[model samples]
Structures are given as C-alpha cells and as structure tokens.
Target: MGYRFHPRSRTIKMDDWIFSPVLQRTYASTEAHYLLLRHLFEGQPIAYCRVSATCNSLNVKARQYHEQMGYKYEGTFRKDNIARWGTPRDSACSSMLDDEWPLNKSVLLTYLLATNFDADGKQIRSLQELRTLQTRCSL
Candidate 1:
C-alpha cells in the first residue's frame, strides 16, 4: 500500500496496493488494510481517505475489495498515469470520509472476528454481505 497525506486538506491518498498470490484466499491483506485505515482515522487528524486502482482486468478484484470495505466510488481518472511499460492507464478512485469511518470500522471489526470464520478458515459471510447487513441495521 502507498499513502500520501495532504496536511491542508487533511486527506490521505492510498495507492499501489498489492497482495501476494501466496496470501490470496486468506484474510491477511484485508486485516492489514483495515488496520491502516483504523490507524489513520483513529490516530490521526484525517478527514478523508482516498484509494485508487488502475482500471484494468488485472485490478478488478482490487476495485471490488475497496468497495467491499465501504469506500464510495468517486469516478475514473482517464489516462492519469503511465504504466511501467509506458502505456497510459486509467484509475478508478474511491474514498471514505471521517464520518463514514465508524460504520466501516464496525463492519470490518465484525468481519475480522474469529467467530466469523470456521475451522477451515472460510468466512461464514463475506465482507460485502456483512456491510449490507450492517447498513440495513443502522437504518
């Protein structure tokens, strides 16, 4: 994960997210990302947190992951960056505001609980599903 902070705006931009193939299907990446968000929102004076994923098939999962974590989609930034191979890349942007963090944090904590997984380490409910349920409960 990459983080850039703007003091004046009290915003943090998170990019360059990666998860090793070996750790796929495990919740390690999810836990780490949530921890980072928790720290930023709870420990720092941040008002907003933005995350971006390169818009491509290879990043579909990454985009979904961010959405599952309750980041609201902003939009795509077309040709905003050049790839390592020099190709123009579009990026999908999303963000979570300070007021929105509490709900997301609750959902994350509930999903990360040991009881949420079984002996086989499979989640009883997905993060997205839990988020939906939590949202409904709040309403």
Candidate 2:
C-alpha cells in the first residue's frame, strides 16, 4: 500500500522515485506532487504540506526541488517517534488553486516558466529533456 495525506500530518512522505534518478533532475516528482495536490483535494484550500528527505540519501538536490515548487524548509526533526532514513527536512508548502491560477495566470505562467526541473522546477524545456531521457514527466 502507498501513503495517504491528511490535515493532521505534520510531515508527509513523498514518493520514493521522486528523488531517485532523473526525477530529481526534473520536476517529474514536483509536477506529480502538484497534480496530486490538484486532484487530491478536489477544490480545497491547502495551507502547507511537510516534505522530508532521508539524510545522506538526499541533500541540495531534494531541497532544490521543494524550493522551486514553493516549499520552504521549516526545520529538521531529529527524532519524533520512529527511526527514519535520516534527519527529515522540515518543509512548509503552498500551491496554486485551480481557480486562482486563472486570476494569476500571467504570474503563475511566469512562475512555471522560471521553474526548471534541473536547477529549477518549471521548465518549458522539460518535455525535450524528458524525450531525450526517454522518461515521462507527466506522472
């Protein structure tokens, strides 16, 4: 079984493949996450979502993904209750609303354009890059 999201979840475990291999180089994970957010809530308000990375397992690469996707690191969790891969990153998250994206179309578009999967989150070149890698960013 996979993980589920809830309002009470302080830190949510993102998909594994998201940070593995090319997904990290591209926003496949981020887009997937956004699409997940867009579809999961089905027209609901999201204040934030906590994301964590396994220590040594990921570092700047994972952090970069969250940043471009609009997640801010809150802090780290040394130990909560269970043992984890590493210290989990404390991330504060936010996303665009379906309707609000319309009002902020231009701004949102620019944000998307500026976002690059590699070194960025939104990348117009992402398709081409994915094609070269024989990978699909669409989740």
Candidate 3:
C-alpha cells in the first residue's frame, strides 16, 4: 500500500492496495485497511481519499471491494500504464470524500463490531448485507 499527499487539494491518493494470497478470503486485510483509513481520517487533514485498481483480472476484483469499503467509482484511465509484458493497462479510479467518511466509517465499524458469525465461524450477515442495512438506515 502507498499514498501521496496533495497539499493544495488536501487529498490523499491511496495507491497499490493489494494483499497476499494467504490473507485473501479472510477479514484480516479488510480490517487492516479500515484501520489505516481510520487513522488517516483522524490524524490528517485530508479532504479526499482516492484509490485505484487495475483492469486486470486479479485487480479487477477490487472494484467491488473498494465500493464495499465506501469508495465511489469515478472513472477508468484507459491505457494509463504499460504492463510488464508491454501491453497497455487501464486503471479504474475511485474516491471517498470527507463528507462521506462518517457513513462509511459507521458501516465499517458495524461490520467489525457485529456478531455475524456462529460457532463454526460462518458468517450470518456478510459485509454487503450489513452495508445495505447501514445505507438504508443512513437514508
């Protein structure tokens, strides 16, 4: 993971947010990501946080994940970068503004604090379900 501060815009450009295979399918990565986001929100003067994911098969999965994490898909930068194999790659961008942080933070906290799992550790209410409920209540 990486970020750059834009002093003029008061924004944090989140970059290269990816996890290892071992952490995949677990809440560890999500939890860690949220914690970091909370830290930034609390400790920084950031007005906007932006994240980008590539259009490749692996990174493409993050588009929905970013939405679940409270980011709104802005647009894709076509042929923004060249891949290791020399092919052009597209980058999908998303952002969360300061005004949206509270709701997103609440949704994240709800998922983190909820008793959504049973004895066997199977989830009763997924993040998506919790997010849906949170959205409805927020409205």
Candidate 4:
C-alpha cells in the first residue's frame, strides 16, 4: 500500500492490504510494505511515512506488524471516525523517519530473500525473530 501525500508534507501513508484467507500468513503484505517504502525513499525526498489502523484486536496485530517493519508508535486518536455500524473507532498511528529506513530496508530484504521456508511455505524465521537476530549481531 502506497499513497501520494500532499506536496506540503514529506510523508507518505501506507494503505491497507486485503487478501483471501488462504493467502494469509504468506508475508505478502510485509513484502508490499517493504517495496512501497523502498520505492518512495529511493524515488523522492520522503522524510517521513505513516500507517494507521483502527482500534481493534486485528488492528492491534496490524500495529505490531508495522512496528516490526520499523515504525514507531505515534499515539492514537480516540473516536477518530465512525464505522459501519455508526460506532466510533480509534485510529492507531505509527511512523518511520528517513534516517531509520536503512536498517528497516536491510532487515526486510533479508527476510524476503531468505530461502528457509519449509515445504508448506511456513517461514523458518519470522520478521521479529530475524529482527532480534539482527539486533544482537549489530550490538
């Protein structure tokens, strides 16, 4: 998911991803997030980027996923918008800065390019797993 923010802002918004249940756990959205950030940072002067999710258990997972991708929690806006049933929903915001891109890009590439998946396509090392290993090695 990629967005073209207004010229006044140097930020890009990461949009949502939807896929069939069978395609879940494939890390497709993770790959797309990496590709979008890479393209934006490499092609233009993007100093910041953000992704938002609704206040729900699923969105909490989404937030965690964004964090694993190197975004920092920026704070949430309670009752940000009304949902389908007219219930107010909160928005969880997370962001990444230009200076933080290199490490994230390298980490994501390592996961995407790894050949450790088993016959059923389950990953041998999850993103968080690889990130921990990367952090340990860096230290």
Query: After aligning candidate 1 to the native by TM-score, how far in Å is the CA of 64 from where it should be?
Result: 0.6
Q: lDDT tens digits, residues 1-139, model 3?
A: 5566675665667655667889865667778978877776665554444433333433767787787788888888887767669988777778877677788888777777637657765667777887789889878
How close to the true structure is residue 58 of candidate 4, measured as C-alpha lDDT?
35
lDDT of 4 by residue, 1-139 (tens): 3344744565655444444677556677678768877876665554444433233323766777667878787877777656659987776767777777777787888888748577776777777887888878878
Count of backbone collisions in candidate 3: 0
Instruction: Rank candidates by TM-score, best first.
Output: 1, 3, 4, 2
How many residue pairs in model 4 have overlapping backbones? 0
Among these predicted structures, which one has the highest lDDT?
Answer: 1
Off by over 4 Å in 3: 44-58
Q: How well is each residue in 21-47 modelled by candidate 1, as lDDT tens digits?
A: 987657887798788888777774544
TM-score of each: 0.88, 0.41, 0.83, 0.78
lDDT of 2 by residue, 1-139 (tens): 1343555743344433234565554444545665554443343555323433222223455555544444335555443323255644333223333443222323223334544334533356543343333323222
Candidate 2 yields a Cα-based lDDT of 0.41
Q: What is the lDDT of residue 12 in candidate 3?
A: 69
Worst 10 residues of 1 by lDDT: 49-58
Per candidate, the number of residue pairs that clash is 0, 5, 0, 0
Off by over 4 Å in 4: 1-4, 45-58
